[model samples]
Target chain A: MGEENVMSDDILVIAEHDGSNVVDVTFEMLSAARELAKDSGGKVLAAMAGGAALAGSLGAFDRVYLIDDPAVSNYSPEAFEKAFTHVVRDVDPGLVLTSTSTMGLDLAGGLSVAWPAPLVSYVVGLGREGDDVVATSQIYGGKLLAEVVVDSPHAICALIAGSFSGQPSPEAGSPDVETVSLEGIGPSRTSALAVHEPDSGGVDITAADILVSVGRGIGSKENLEIIEELAEALGAPLAASRPVTDQGWLSKPHQVGKSGKKVKPRAYLAFGISGAPEHLEGMRDSELIIACNTDPDAPIFDVAHYGTTVDLFDLVPELTECIQA
Target chain B: MVLLKQLPDLVEELEPSPDGTDIDREFIKFILNEFDDQALEEALVTKESSGAEVIVVALDEPEVDQVLYTALAKGADRAVKLTGVPAGTWVPTHLRAAILAPFVRELAPDLVLTGVQSAEDLDGQLASLLGGYLDLPHAAVVVGLEVKDSIARVVQELGSGRSVEEQITLPAVLGIQAASQAPRYAPISKIRQAMQAGGLEELEAPAPVDSADIAIAQVRIRRLYAPEKSTHAEMLTGDPGEVATRIAEILRSKGLVKA
Candidate 1:
């Protein structure tokens, strides 16, 4: 009974990994959890399924729980949720933190409901205030920031990307890994038939050092050459917003956003891209950001280190000329 | 059935309230959510294929009647306006899902469809929450769906240009990201004709479950504010030549390019 009472105050961080490589968001959640745990006087526990070996590197947590199930080697929402739900029930953590990634969003929705815990998604900030855990989230397409207090005894949160910085734990001690088996988790109502990878013909923008990104304001496919020249002159990769890719002006590999790739280039030159929250979540952490859009009030200006309101059609050729000269 | 919502269009200027808890609604224009429009289009497509009924349910809001009529014009078979939830009130997703579950149960819909996420979604994931309440399987960010023999074959977007195809059992919920094609545009004349036909129905919201009340009380919004701008961007002006020169100079100064 006393051990159960002690476990109730624990904060659980769901570590995301793809069998071999641990996702950066896992470390990011550990950082956020550490801050919250400090104020709440709770221990941070990290949990993962299938990546038992990677658990030892997550020294940030007080304890690490690993669920090894061959059935969960791939990303099955049903299997992962079963493992996570089992861990949550056994540990009874005060707070559960997961990423706002595809898998995270998928698992969080069902888990929050099954646990009957309050869920706060797209969280950008987390803190503790007088016995309550507060989470700040963006709403209205990033125009408004809402401060929400999780009032349930147990709460689950999906943290947005670029909200918190991920740092390895400096505490210099390995986490004790406890392998739990989720055998006989019932059959899933949904079955993943196959995975379709996007056509690979272009540079992967996620690995680019510098990115010249375009959006809807590029107008048409013919105007793409001007930006292409600019990207070539700068020796940077070319990327685009969702609309550009959706229109087939650019391929899926060149798309950068929440639905696309999250990139952290040294410099990101955003042209005609209105900073929607989704797009910003992917490339907001660039070392230097410069945006040029026709609309001065575009949210891209809010995050850009340097910005200009100019028609890209007229501006791109001149900019390319100036660079080439 | 499809779930629709009216949202204050974010394209226009938004001013904060005096208390800074929400946007000032005095001048904001309201429109059907973009994703919900896509969801409606998906439902219409499903109806065409499976001979299913496409019913649109929306909360009572400013100009919502017009939205319902527009959905009708766009090929919805029926429209329902849920009463009792006040307009302009921010209802959390869980409570909204709880309130919607009873109505959905009564409808006995074979499949429930909603937008994957809304522009104003803070706590978000209404379809998933509703699925939980209804004890059904739910899929989010579904880009393609086909219904046959009460089963749904769906293509779910998994971000980073990856997608997964899934076969979900009957009586499931799908959060639509987009349909195979863009939502068809309904001419104003068609909408006017729909309004004249008058197929709109109003249903009073059922009594709230006890859990919904507690959930609402627990989600106390401490404040609402615009995020602080950490960097003051240098806004370049003048002709394209001058701006280009300035950009070149800036780039050269940063050693990103050789002058």
Candidate 2:
């Protein structure tokens, strides 16, 4: 369980890879880690779980650990748990940080169970606490913010994807790369199939610059044609709350919310959405939000930049015609 | 069958910060999450098919008894309030599993069910974390379930638009999705019976685990504010061509169209 060079208090950030590429959240977590490392006088280490040549691509960290094994070919909770458990033991980091992605949540949950230390997920803000680190997390579906103090010598937390916008790296970008072997550590159960990306290419809404969204108030499937035109006119992709996707007017890939993709687009034009708590959870990070709905009292209007009480069916067509002109 | 914790009244009016940051209350009211209602619905269906006695349970203030009463009104054969657990404290999924384990083990239900995540906590870690603590087969975001013999086949939603079917031996934990099944409303007659039955057992609270290792370190308010309002669309009251010109201009300014 002991490694010769493991640092007991180094902050470990488990990097996330989209099978072939490292997700942007990796850098976001690194940015958060840089702050913690500075305060605690600890080093920030990036752990690449899987994928091709990613360990070399991430150059911002002081140390990079590549846990590449034939067994960890895909996103399996068991595989990640084994690899992360090894990393924690090997590195002996005081704090373990990861991006709160689908894989991250699963891995973090497993770590909490495997280790006696405290684990936090979906962290939006972080700072150092004398020797420990404090994190601000959005709980209760973005309705409230909780300040958590992770005092464990071995504390683990997952950073939310757009919590802190990425910052420029001032240090010369050369990091030491260490390839770790997963000889004995392996997943109990495997994915049993190839990893496939959908047609939308798993576009992250949180990172998009512009968004066009449809909601339940958008009315009927025929009405979707108007929003599609709007998206087409703007050259922006189409997104919707859960109801639109459930109706099959839009594919599940286009759904945005706590249950869907969390988007932080520069501009998000939401049409006909009721702004339910779960629906709002995903888009809480968008920079500019616009709501067009019949109900002036819609919860979405409470947080929107521009609000209209006119029926979307009437407004959408009129708006579409105006945009086309 | 699965247990869903009933929620206390929602305090939607509380906007502590004009910017929508920080909660004024030390603890918000408790209530069962909406998705958990769907889990209860799925359990009710399983009970109907197999004639199994489904027991719904919760750990909260007596205010939640009305929710359990509502569950019974919907068709749960039995409902009980789990005592011993403190209200308003952040209960990790593993701790909850530990508390529920002995009781669940004693009852020995064929399957365990709960809402995929709690509404109030929004941790979304319970079902999976509980499964780990129990060391049993578990699935999250289960969209479909079919039980035959002692085996349960479930359709689970993974990331992206993909889904997979997995079969588990009896006694599994499933974190249900809100879209998985439609939650049925409780009939008025059953609601009355559940409220009148009044013999719900309250269990003792489990020991509090020290969160010092995982305590809240510090909180930062990163631009907390209510969602902003969208700009009013300048209505184009003219023919299609004229409207199109205005639309194009707007789209162009928005960088959505060629100028």
Candidate 3:
């Protein structure tokens, strides 16, 4: 079932920050929002929950709604949702865009239900199909893509990182900034405690010229030693996919994914790692990539410069011996 | 304290139906979602640490009874199946929340936990929607959870290895990203024993009466297809040593491998 297509196509970008600076994803959204604005004819508006200082970076947008609330300044989920809902309810834009990041994931799903809008998430592609908003979402760990049609006048699209090229110009005065207070946010039952940065256990994988990454294909935690030997022979740091770290076989610092760390090493040797979009987002930009997996259809081959359907156990030991020789 | 979902196993090949809305699930192997397994583990761990009763729930499916039995094997106190939703059909996140709301209201537990996401829908959304529907506070991507008195302390994963700790009052919902430890395996004997005991409770509930819940996006999927191969890797056809030597040569040619 679809709704009547009205002309309230103004796009709202829920801008996020690294505490103080506007995030790069916000700019990419602006770039897409610019294209969408042409078709929309309505203005592009960015709602910054607490990003007043970073408003200067959003020159490409038409206007900025600065939710000037202190609770939102620090992200306690309850307060931030209340602050965002307050602005969205008042503005009532047609399309709401946010990144599918840690905070964005919560807001996208929460606000969609709270605002009562339909939401399309894990979106890699976004475009307007006449009156309908078309979104392509990566599902089943990037095994497949779903083409979704948002037949409603108002919708929310949570974009995956790197889906668009967004370079925000650091200029001001393009858009009017409206300062507003929290109108209806209730007392937050949730409160922040402290933040911990993932310790790399003294290894900075991002700085490595060559990264030897392993995925779930490595089999067991005891088998990690084989991959480690290869990394040692190659003079590289050992990195892994989320599953490996989630299993506690390695530290979070050794993780390569959208959530872990983005690395552009001189060479990335992936063993047994199927390239989920999340993992691909982190290491796909390496100078040269070589993938080893048992599955020929593994998506890692799509990004690898050279790939082989070799059993990682067989290939890894041989590769280590060759490197040592 | 725990909710679960069974999803199409990733190991199985997934093919889109001719109509293009969903995958051909008739031949697909169904398994508990990986994150949901972690949710169950977290709930069990919390029960051990904080002295609470752990109840596991899922929508009724042909294979759901086995999953519930497994949960029981892993130390869940009770198992419940909300039945009567058509099998082999898609249930949107909102409807799942709608269906579970009345049951949740009935239990009124201290905390509700579910996987941060499932392959089908809602990456870190199910718990959020459940919280909204039940008018409770919510958090997502929670990697660590600790309950004390009437508060839940959660270690939430932010991007780039950054994590923040947050405390929530009891009777809240959480989208659990992982348990403190990996899910423990249940023995085959225990699973068999739990299944024979047959204490799994069932309640029949159809789709909500106000199904029109007027969502803007109106969650109907249109098509499913594979991503185009914008680039394909050059397959290195050789012995393991030969492929390694070639990889070494390529790295050196790229000026990455130092002599």
If scored against the real structure, what TM-score would every candidate get? 0.89, 0.74, 0.96
Best by lDDT: 3
Tell me which residue pairs clash in candidate 1. Answer: none
DockQ of each: 0.55, 0.19, 0.66
Residue B82 displacement in candidate 1 (angstroms): 1.4
**Shift in Å, residue A116, candidate 3:** 1.2
Interface RMSD of each: 2.7, 6.9, 2.1
Candidate 2 overall lDDT versus native: 0.65
Measured with C-alpha atoms, the lDDT of residue A37 in candidate 2 is 76
Name the lDDT value of residue B20 in candidate 1. 73
Task: Give the per-residue lDDT of model 2 (tens digit) for B156-179.
Answer: 554444445556676777777644
- For model 1, how does the per-residue alpha-carbon lDDT over A138-217 read when each residue is reduced to its tens digit? 88877778898866677888898667888665564888888888776677787778777765576778777778999988
Q: Which run of 10 residues does model 3 chain A get worst, by summed lDDT?
A: A1-10
